[model samples]
Each structure stands twice: as C-alpha cells, then as structure tokens.
Target: MVQLSNNSALIFDGLALESYVSGKRSFMRTPSVSLLLPSPEGTRRAFLIMRNVTAINPLCLPAKAWQQNVAAAVRPAQLPGVQSHSGCHNQTGTCVDDSNAPVWQRCWKQVCQNIDVACSGARLNSAGNPAPTYYDINLLDVALFCPVVLDQACLDSLGPLGCTLLYESGAGPGMLPAAPLAVALGDATGSQGGGHGSATPLVVGVIVGGVVLLVVAVGVVVLLVRRRRPQAQTAKTGGAPFHEGLDSLGTRSTTSAAGTVGLSMLPTESTARAFPTMGSAGSGATGSGHAAPSTWPLPDANKRAHSQGSDTTVITNQTPIGDCEFDVKIEMPPQDGVAGACVGGSAQPDVQLTGIVLGRGAFGRVYQGIYNGQAVAVKLLTELTVDSADQACEAMMQELEVLGRCNHPNVVKVLAASSLDAARPALVLELMETSLDKVLYAKPGHLLSLQLVLHIALETAKGLAYLHPTVLHRDLKPANVLLRDPGSDKPVVKLSDFGLSRIRHSVLKTMHPEAGTPAYMAPECFDLTAGGLTHRTDCYSFGVLLWEMLAGAQPWYGMTAVQIAYEVTLLSRRLPLRPKNTPGGQVLERWPHRLSALLSGCFERDPQRRPAAADIVKALALAQQDLDNLSRRATPTRTAVE
Candidate 1:
C-alpha cells in the first residue's frame, strides 16, 4: 500500500465496494483501515474493513493478509442486540449488512413482474399452449443485470452515507444504476416498457416497424405474384387474349371456357368484349348454338364465318339483351332414345375410369378420372339388392349432407353428383391418388416414416375436429383416406370418401343398419342392442386407422368378413403391435416414443378413453415440432416422397 504524503491512499486489488461511489471513479491504495458510519447513538458507529490495497505505482498485497489487517482495524459497534465484526466475519444486527436486502427483495419482485408481463404480452396461456421461446443468452443477460442494478439503487435510496450521485445516476429516468456503474452497463440501451401512456409509443414503433416490413414484403410479393399470375393465366390460355377489349367494353372472360368445351365466341368490342368458349352461357348469347366444328386447331376464319352463319339463325330465335321475353338456347344432350342397358354395363356415363382404381367393394367401384379435363375420381354404385341399394343411397345422401357443409383442406371435397338415375347414381370428386391402404400395404418395401405418419394423424384429427361431437365417420378405414399433392414445403394428407359418414343431430335418433370396413369396425358395432353410431364409433375407427398407419398395414386380416367381425367382437383383439420390433411387431420401430403412446391412445379399446381429434391434433403437432427440431439437423424422415 502507498500512502501519498498528502494523506490520500491508493488501492487496486480485490476490493469489494461496500457503498456506491459519489464522484468520478478513481482507484487508490489505502493501508488496511476501518471505515465507520455514525450510529443513531453518537458514541456508537458501524464499522467495516477495506482490503487488498494496491497503490497507483503497482504495489500489491496478498488478499488474505490485507483482509487480516483490515479486520484488526475494525471496531465492533456497541448497539443493543447487535454483534458487529471486522471485515469478513458473519455479523448480525442493524449494524451489519442489511444493505442489500431491500434492493434484492425489490429486484426479486420485479423479476416476477417481468415474467407476468412476458406472459401477458405474448398472449401465452390462451386457447393453446404458447410456442416456446428459443433460449436466448442475450435476453438472459438483460434479465439478470436489470434486477442487480435495481437492487443496488434500492439499497442506496434506502441507506445514506454512500455517494448518491454515482450510485443513483443513469443515462435515462427509471434506468438509474442500482448497482456499480460497471455492472449496470451493457451493450443494449433502450427503455423496455414505459408507463401505460408511454408504452403506446414503443408499441407503436414496433408495430410500425413490423407493418413497414410486412408492407414492403407484400408489395414485392404482389409485384412478383402479379407478374407471375398473368404469365400463368396466359400460359394456361395457350397465349389466347380473352381480355383484350375487357377494359373498354366492360366484359369479362375466364379460362373456364376451355374446361367445359372448346372455342366460345363473344360479340365484338361495341357489343360484348370477351368471348365465351364452348358450353358456358352468357347474358347476351345463347350457349347451345353451333358446337365448335373441331376440338383441335380451333376454327379458322372461313370455318368461323360458316359457323357464325348457322349461329345467326339460332341467335335470331334467342332473346336480345333488352327483351323481357327471349328464347335462350340451352346446351342439351342430343335427343336419342335411352340406350338399352346390359345387365352389367355402366348406366350412362355416371361412372368413368382412369385405370387407377382406388377401391372397390360390394357397394361400388371408385376410379380416378379427368372430369371436364380436371382430375376427378368418380364412384359408381354397383348393382345391389333393392334394399341394399336403398340403404347405400341413403348413406350417400347423408355423406353429401355432411361434406357439403364442410369446407376444409383436410376433409374430402364433394363436387358434382348425378341423382337423376336412381339405378346408377354417381359422385364426382377431386382426385387424390394415395389411399391409406395403398400407403400401408400397396408399396411393400416402403417404411412409414415418423414424420409422414404424424402428419396423417394430424390431418385426420383436423378433419374430425371440424365435425361436431354428434357427427361421426362410421366407416373410417385406410380405403377412405386419399392423399393429395399439395405442392408445399409440407404437403398435406387429405381424408376422402365420406360414404359411410353420419350426422346425428343429437342422441335422440340416428340411422341404424351398422356398417363399415370389418377390420376397422369398432367393438361397439357388434353391440347392436345399444346404438353405437356416435362420435365414439368414429374414435374407434380412428384408433384402427392410427394402428394401420403405424403398423403400415391393416390391424387384423386373414378372415372372411363375418369371421373378422366375430374375432373383433368376441376376442376383443386390439392391434397386435407395440412401439418395439418383433415378428409382426409395432408399426415403425423407429417412431418417437411419445408418438407411439399417442397412437395407442387413439386405438384404445374403450371409446371414452380416446382423446378427441382436436387434442390428438395438438399432440401430433407437438410431436411434429419435436421431429422438426431433429429434422433441421438432418434430413427429415417425413419427406412426402412419391
């Protein structure tokens, strides 16, 4: 230690500041000396030792020796019920260090307040569990330091004799340094949240910044999307200009003209701006007049003129724009006596084929097709006994009722239907190629990756979630599932074929004659005595479907339909698989344990035990997140490969 001749001291080594410094900071060395604060009783005083003195000239002292010297110099305070000690000893009473207690308590309270603020601010604990924040060391640093400073300031404000200016001062209000300036300083500088009124500006700034970014991104995207949309429409049109005169004539045309028929004509610019293609009708013209002469190489001038001449006769008979009464031409099938039907021949064009048969049963055959040139699958009801046909028609009507009300990506879409011929009713649907059965069994060598399986489960649950608890898919099976090429980062798996679906308004009354795939049939189906067509039946079917996805095949097999039903009913045989691998073991051996447990829950023997599809979706999504975390580090197991 160096003592200047001027009675000043210098210390640099191992010095823990007992109080906040008052002025511009400077280091000095001091001979181990005890400092005192006068007590309430003038004769008594609080004493503490300063240690490990180092002079400005680089003098040093062993920390322990310095501590000993400081201890020797300190005098115990003579306060009632208080025991004071030198430098480092544990001391008790008002005379000892309660200096930091209030500060720490205040800091702790703020920590809890901050947590509450975060919870409320982020909207966590809402309808669903909040997505977790990524662990951030930077935020932690801020959290840790903010309180430490507050605690120091809290101590300083409560106690006197410390340098208040250096201790309490901050760059801004409410950001006062509670602790040492060194501890308080960080790379970050900003007010976190202000008073209620002040908070608005910061929030506004953040929102404005976000909105600015969003607007910029949206603008760029709109520009690109605008450019691309027109290009796409033009390309799809085969470079035809349907809107050339649309702006001036206030007429509109669309690519749909190519869908139902070939070339459709429009009146010129003074009359109608855009042309209608084949079969579609417009307000000004009758749709049925001369069909385009050829499918390919759309009509040349001579051919068009010839067709126009023929159309003039038909147009003359049709109503003009202003006429209250007009004979509008309507497209109708050419008049012919109904073709004689062979016993097994398709009744009219109710059923069409694409050679890709998805499923066939006693009820009907479902084949993928190109309806109106857009891909669709057509289901033709097979001839059945009068009673079975009636039952099947009833089922189809119920399905149509349910599907019509539902508009979700995961649920199958019902398009056009032909009920005109009760003998051969048909339904047209958007085509989806991959069926759960095809995914499970058709491709023998492929393994059901954990990711794809979870996705299917999630999507199925989503579909079920859309339906009220009263409605149920009585016939949930692999065959009922259809996959679409969603053209996305994570393309979706869609559920299709609502044919055995039922919507019961309530427990009061529901259709009977229990039916569904045998292997997927829930045990409740066997309980004909009790009505089993509730949502629980769907749950049971879901369980079986989950089992199939996990197992990569149907749960039960090798029996006639009757025998399978008997076994399912009498044996109470659940899917014969577990999460582990053995001969005929659980589905994918590599699936996550949590996912396996979730799948088991779906297939539970008791209907009441099963989680709702919404909960299931939540669980699967969580599992998917876990899988995604693992996926980011490596190629995801759930790539939607063709």
Candidate 2:
C-alpha cells in the first residue's frame, strides 16, 4: 500500500519513494512529481526523464520547502537499510538469485499499484467524476513504462519485466552502474541494525537517494532555461486599446443596445422609392401619372414641391427646364441579369434600412433592416473609394454567387441585393439573433448544454457538406456561425459570412494567399504551396470550433494568432483534448468514446485522413442519441427531488 503524507507533498510505498515537487520557480511553472522504482533486472539503478511531468499532489507545497525536503532525502546517510542484494551477480552463468526474486516482485507490485491508482484517478476525473486525488500522468514513452492498456495489465500481473521486453528504447538495468554512495550507505545502515541485513530495504533507500539528486539537478536546469527564455505577451481581453485592423480578424468588440437600427431612422419613403425598380420601367411614376425612369438625377435640397389635394408625395428635382434627368445612368440588375429578378413585371419590394449596427466586419457593416415588412440583415460596403470600389464589388459579387448556390436551411439566406453604384452596394440577408462567439463570451451565466453543442455541430457539418462540391468557407470560426432565436429555449445555428469563401476549383488551381482567423486555421492553410485549400481544411477548423465549445475558453488564449499558427503548423502542438478543472472539462468527461474519436479524426494533421462532413454528421447523430438517453434517465431523478 502507498501512503500519502499529511500535507500530501510526499507519497510513501514500502518499495519506493515518490514525492511532489513545486514548479513555481521553474520555467513553464507546472507542478511536477518524481517517482523512483527499481529496474526490472532486480537492481537499484533506474532511469529518469524530466519532461512533461504531471502534478499529483493536492497540497501544492512551496518551492523552498520542496527543495529543502528533496535535498535532505538525497543524502546517503539519511537513507535507511540500503544494501546490495547477496547472490545477485553480473556473471556469465546467472544474474538472478532465488532470495532476491520475491523482494523485487513485491517492490514492482507496489509501484504498479500506485501508478494504477494515479492513472485511474486521472481518467475518472477526466470523465467528470470527482475523484479524491488529481493526477497528471505523462503517457509519453520517455517514462520507463508507458501506461498503455497491455503494459498496465502486465504491470498488474507482474509478468516478464525488462527494458528490452517492455520498451523499444530507454536505459536498462544492465547498462547502468549501481550508485556507490547508496550501496555504502545501505551497508552502513545494515551493520548498525544489529548486522541483520536485507537487500530490499537498503535498495529502496538507495533508489530514493538517487531520484532525489536527479530531481534537484533537473529543477536547477529548468530554472536556468526559464530565466533565459523570453516571455510571450498575451493579448488582453479587458481595458486594452483595440488594435487597428484587429477587428477584421474576427475579434469581438463592445456593442450597445443603442446600436440597434430601427425602421424610423431610414431615408424618407420618397427618397428610398426613387432607386431603380428592375423589370418595371414605370414603377417610379408619381401621382400625376408621369412615368419616370429608374435612373434619375438627385433633387436639390431646397426644392420642395407640394402635392395637390391628395396627400400624394411628389419628389421633383430642381433642374432647369428641358434638362435631361437621366444624365448619370446606373444599371441595377440581379446576378446573371436573370435569377431573383422581378418576374412578370412585378414591382420590387421596398427595403428600409434601420440604421442599426448589427456588427462590423473587415470591409462591411451588417445592419438590421426591413425587407418588404420582414426583418432582415443588411450588409453594406463601407470605406469604399474609387481605387477599392471595384475590389469590394467583386467580393460582393462572389459572395452573392456562392450564397445563391447554397440553399440549405443551415446556411443564411440572401434576400435581395442592390448595386446602384459599385462604391455603395448592399445585400439583404436573413437576420439572426446572435453569433456563437457572442453567446460563448458575452453571456457567461447561460452556458450551452451538451445537447445544443451537438446540435450546432451537426448543423455546421450539414452546411459544410452542402457547400463541399462548389464552395469553401475559408474562414469557419465560431464568430461566423449565427444563432437564430438565441433567447428561445430551442435555438438554431446557421452559417454566415461568406466573404472569404472560394470556389473549390478556383482554390485548387491558384495558390492564393492565406486568409483566415489564425486560431481556427488548419495546418495546410499556413502553407498554400503544399496544396491549396480543400474541404478538409474546413474540417480542421470545425474541430477547433468544437473544442472551443466544449472547453468554453478560447484555444491558446494567451498566445497571439501568429504564435498559435507557428506552433500548430510548424511545431505540431495541439491543445489538450480535455480542459482541466473547468465546466467544459465536466462536459468532456461525459463525451462518448465515439464522439471523442470523431473529434480526433477531424483534427488529424493529414488532410486526407480527416473524415468527410457526412461522416461527422452521422457520428454526431449517434452522440446526440446517447446524450438524449442520459437526459431522460436524469429527468426522473430530478423530478423525485423536486
């Protein structure tokens, strides 16, 4: 049995010594622990790797005390009963002895049991259960025994054990020499204890002393490295000046209720009505029955004409008599000059801009508007100039073309568009209550239930699947996903913001410059020369989005976008699959194995290995069913309590 110290700083098993170390003074500053176990060859020599250590202690000891205690433990004289096992030889005939076999077995058994308890606790806590102790185990191969299922079983069974048999590479007992100080100390302790010597107790103390020295050395090296390493500045979430062009990178900004645009704030009815009505030539005709062309000169501000006897508003321009009104004609036509155009000479429905700012993007500002009495969102090109107007117009046209093809319910619908001038064009679209990013960051109290997350995931996959053959949503972050009826009990998610979308064929043919929010960007996006954007790129972003929803925290929150891009693409580091000690961690614990596997598949670095949207949809559906059943079972228990 392994026993925890009163403060939980040290753990004691009869076979080995394990102690927690505080990393507050070291770089990375992550708390770590050290465990020393006898080598499989029945020797006191052991190997230690000082990377990726997990904190196992709950006490959280101070660095000073940890160092002091650790230092004291490494002294040879301080160790008790450490002696060389007799009859255990490094001879040609035999290295193993009968008397020493049982001692090694007991020692190995205790070490395995302690490891099992730690790993099992970690796994249980990861699944959302409140385990008494928290343990962070490094499953990396640097450790003598990786905690794989088969190895764990072997450890439990005390089966054939050796570095050669257990691991592919690492120091084995045969390769290392026994510590002379430890062996001498063990001999001294054995002589002092009435000359009744035993190898097991002596070996345990010697091993403990060696581990102590190694840990101290590693700690000092880690401290020096940390002091020399430059600290990366983290982006502040509060009270910092907003960086220019940072808004374009999908960063959320402060907005107010007064920002909402209502119908009363729009241009006067007559002025709004003067814009050309395509397919109907006389649609702008006044009450006097004089037909006016859609393209007409602007009226002088001082010239107000009164209507005669009929409350009919007449807008007359103050132009000299015989002056042609249609001096600057502007052609307004639907895309391809056909689809979505007024059919059978029907009058175009009037749309009024509410002047409310829904949100601002890199090139446009979305507003609340009323289209033919139905609420809609209006995306108006902003900061346009003679030089950039053509570029903006092209982008608007591209989005229109893409949105025109996508008719899925999961995708935002484009209602209408008018490009009276390339400099000032507008697109009316289906209005949504809020964006997923706003729901996640703005409202902390109202956390999304697991069911809602699954629903959103399913819908997002469906939308992507529908767009796969033709369109690629180059930027697929949570900010672009809008939630409809967000205040309602059952909110629905829809994909929006197609400005960065590209036609799949076009993306493949040309090595276009990378464009996207870096946090959600895939590894391939960092290098366009490797291969142009593929449908799998969207899948990678989706995996990050899913992780954000589950964790309820931005991925790599402290790191800058560039830093994240570099680390993720070049260094190949990924965010932890499960959050530590957060509400999101609780949710992740309840995640089904298949759901976890699906997420893993989506995040595969190899684009070709990633599963298609269809597969993701199917997997989410199964996960949703499992969640539903769990909810049903919990409902009865809640009712009984109430």
Candidate 3:
C-alpha cells in the first residue's frame, strides 16, 4: 500500500486494487489502475497500483515480475520514462544496485521525475564511506555511451512525444533538444490546478492534454530543424558565407559605380569558399607568412560583363541597352587618330552632396553623395597649389577621358562631370564599398581561398584586357581596385582611379615625368626613353598586386617610394618569391603547378615574357578548375560549430 497526498491511499489486494480517500467512501476496485496526483508546485505525479501481489514486501517481488509490471505501467514508448529494470529499484524505494543495467536506464527514473535524490548505503568507497549515487545524466553522455540505440533512425522513429520526453530526460547527440524539452517541462508543470478536491479523471485529462500540446510543439520544432539541415550542412562543408537563391549556373545581378547595370555568372558560393588560401591580404610578394582571406566583395550583375574584344557577349540572361546620355567625356584625341569622341551631358543640379568623405588621395577627395536618390561617389579635384593649377586641370581631364571611353564591366564608369566652374571640377562616379588595399589591411587574419584570389585576378585582368589597345591604367595597385559589397552574393571588384591613365597611342610617343606610384611602376616606366610605356606596364603592376595578395604583407617594407624606385631601376631588384618552408610558402604549396608557373610568368622581368591580360584570365580559369575538381573529390567532415 502506498499513501498519496490529499489523504488518498492505493491498496493492493491479492487479485484487485482499491482507491480510497479518508473521510470518504472507497471509490472503486479494479484489476489495474493508475492515478495522476497534483502536487503543491502544480506538477503532476503518476502513481501505478500493483494488483495481485503475492508478497507484501516490494523487495521480495520476483525480478522478472517487477520488470514486467514497471514496463507495462510506465510504457516508455508512450510516456518517455524509464524502460523498467527490476534491479534499478529495491524495496527501500531507493534506486540502488543497478550495476547490471546500462547507465542510461539506471538514471532514467530520476530524470523522468525531475529530481536529484541521493542514494545512501548503496555502495562503499575506497575510503570506507558510503559512495554517493547521482541519478542525473546528460544527453551527450547518453549518446556517447549508447550511440547505436539513439542513432538518427531510432530518434526519428520515437515520434515527437517520445522523443521530446527522452530528450528532456537526457537523450540525443547535441544540446539542440534541451530547449524544446525545457519548454515542454515548463508548460506541463504550469498547467496543473491547485485545488485539492479536483476529480482524478479531470486531473488525468489535464496531464494528457499538456502532453499532447508538448508533442505538437516538439513536432513543429522537429520540422523546422529538418528544413534547416541542408543549409547548415552546406555552411559547414563550404566554409564560406552563405548566399540565398544562388543557382547552379552561378549567375547574379550587379550594378557598377557608374550605375551601369549588368549580369555576372560565376561559381557558386560553396565552390568559392572551398578554394584554399594562397596568401594573406595586403602582404607583399616577399612576406614570410600568409593571412586568411578577408571578406572580398564580388561583382554584381550591374557591374560585371563578358565581352570578346568589341563584341559584348551576354552570358547571363539579361537585355543589353544602347549607350546612355551619361557617356564619359574624352577631351583627348581618340586612339589611332580615330575621329569619333565620347561625350556626356553636364551634371544635374538635383545631385545632392552629403559631404561625407569616403577616401582621400593625392589627386582629390572622394565623397559619398546622392544623385537621383541613388548613392554615388563624387571625386573632387584638390585645390590647386600656387603653380600647379594647369597640371591639376590636365590630370582631371585625363582621368575624365580615360573613364569616359571605358564601357567594360570590370572598369569603373563616369556617371557625369561638372566643369562649368573649372576651379571646382567634380566627377560623379558610382560608389564602391571599399578598396582592395583597405580590405587587406582591415582583415589581416582573414585568409582568402585560392578560388576567390583567382577570381579577383581574373576580373582585374579582364578590366586591364579591355583597357589595352585603347587605354592604359598607368597606376594599377590594390588601392585602385575597388570592391562592391554584394551583401549575400560574392563581392565584385572594379578597377578605378585613372588619374595617371593614358590613351594607348599617346603613351607610345609621350615621355612625360613619372606619374604613378613608384612601387608599382615597371622597370621600363623608370626610364621612359628605354621604351615608351605600353599596356605591358600595367601587367607589371598586376604581377606585383598578385604577389601582394599571396604574401599578405607590404611590398618592400622599410623602404620609401624613392628607395623602391631606385632598387627596381638602378639595382635591377624584383620582389622575392617565398621560400619552400615559410608560412606564406605553405599557402602557395597547395596551389597547382600551373598556377605557380603562371605567377612566375606574370612576374617575369621581361615585359614581353609576361602574359597578356586575356592570357592571365585563361590561366586563372584553369587554376579555378583544378580547385573545383579537388572539392568534388573531397569528403565531407562533421563539424560541431554551426
């Protein structure tokens, strides 16, 4: 006989059971019966009545009979409590001497009861003291101890109710089940009535209702988890930022700094993320260690384009439009003495100035502005020095000329120009999030994967390729490479800042003073008399940029611009390659031999030996293919982090 609160008693007869309340008549006698009694804390406790007990003492009951009774009463499949072990509990009502049972089963009774009762005199310790027994067990411990029983298939088959109960009672592989179980437990404990005279049937009904509600809630959670599994797996395996709606073809829409809209189709985010890191950002070609890739923005549809020479190839699904009124204005004579000139209308007065400076350079200051309610970057020429007014004007016009003629996707565009007041000339250009130089320096530890580096190399080369035969970006460095933040898509890189750029034909005859960053200047650039500056000059700067991307350190550290110029011009010194065992070299070690050879070719001292921009694109494509193949052959690894 067991006594419950509210003066209730469960009496076991030899063949039947009776539930009686003090000061009230006996309710009923039945072969098998159960009662759900409400506690002061508003939690329900389940009590089972054992009928036809041959032995009055609970401990004297046969082990097999006890197991059968407990199993039938608890019904773990339906209630998610203990599976019933005769050895788990003895006559004293203490959970003890359950060494033969699995650890999970030994602790299941306490887990289901949500209690922390201590066992006394269960076993002896080496110190001759009573060894304490804890009924609490963690879910991770259960999964680790009994992986086969709690495998994915078994967990799924448990259904929401059983699974929630088991999970709440400490079962599963991760902490994911803890939250839902907590909610279920809290709700179950909060829904009970405090009245003492409530009917047994009403109390049971409430408990059942709470269980059903908890099951539904857990089922909903299970569905949501199943839905996010694919995305979570992709993020874990890919190791790159996830993007939504990215399709197999890797196509996306982008807008340029010039407001020119275009479409770009590149590799998917997973493919890009899997690319290995080649070097640290901003590290010079000779740096000893490599830095992880930072978040480099990929070009969007408006800023990316594919073209073969003069023919625009629409690889992505987009419509092409004719030239707009905002065409760039070229003051200089056309290349090869061509008669046609590209001109654009004056800037609209409606353009609003925000006065927020985005960046500053020797030539001018770039400010974040708004035009037609769209964000833009406005480059204003610096105030002329006492004797440099004419020179500054000429530089501004040269920039306008080069930018105006450029319609390629990778090149920055000029939206409009205002020279009506020559003293305050300004160029309204498309705004970019930041420059490659800033990206490298800002995120020193974020190593870029090889695939993304190759992509940048290819895009930069494409811009240069388009500029060749018509224009030359005399100053090509990481600083000039502008990036657009695509939010969810990969970042887009565009070549900007053409203050020193020159038309190809004019460069062949002109022997002007040095006009670009000395560190990026090719050997020929130091002595214009050796051979006129050509498109190849840009190649040399590109090679240096490549080295910077791989080395992730400053070029010629501890040397000034003058020293760098002298070293390349007089000493005939070039950027050094990484030795085999260095940290930076380790990054390069993963590269395919073809890629290494390509880098070597790009850095060749002989201008003629260096590959053209188009050739560089082809080489990068091949390297990217190698990376894709490697990713395909790789097996997925399980990660604990999201």
Q: Estimate each model's TM-score.
A: 0.42, 0.45, 0.45
Instruction: Provide the overall lDDT of each model, using Cα atoms, as 2-decimal numbers.
Output: 0.39, 0.44, 0.44
**lDDT of candidate 3 over 1-642, digit per residue (tens):** 111222111222221111111111111101111122222222122222222221111011123322232333212121234432213232234432222222233222112111111111011235422221111111110111111122333224443223323433323322111111001001112331111110111111112312223353344334434423333445432212222232343322121111111112222121110111111122221223322122212223244432333422211101121121232232212356564232233343534556577888665678777766788887776655767766776676667656655667787877776642354567778888888888767765554556667778888988887777336678899999998872322578899988776643112323352668877878767763332445667888887887777666666767887888789878878876763332355575445687667767766655667887778878878877888788866845455332
How many times do residue backbones clash in model 1? 11
Error of 1 at 209 (Å): 87
| TM-score ranking, best first | 3, 2, 1
Off by over 4 Å in 1: 1-359, 367-373, 385-387, 420-422, 486-489, 508-513, 559-573, 577-591, 632-642
Tens-digit per-residue lDDT, 1-642, candidate 1: 001111111111222222111121211112111111111222111111122311111111122322332222212212112112232222123321111122222111112101100010011123321221111000001111011122333323332112222223321112211111211101112211111100000000011111223353344334333323322354532322222112232321121211110111122121111111111112111222222221112112122221211111111101111101111111112225543332223333433355566678678777675545477766667656877987777656655545544556777766655551346556666678667676566556455666677777787877776653534667777777777653333556667767665433222122242466777776757654332244656767787787666655556656776777677667766665463432224434445677667767766655556777667778888988888887786763466442
Least accurate 10 contiguous residues by lDDT in model 1: 197-206
lDDT of 2 at 251: 21
Q: What's model 2's overall lDDT?
A: 0.44
What ranking of all candidate models by lDDT puts the best one first?
2, 3, 1
Badly placed stretches (over 4 Å) of model 2 are 1-349, 385-387, 586-590, 635-642
Which scores higher on TM-score, 1 or 2? Answer: 2
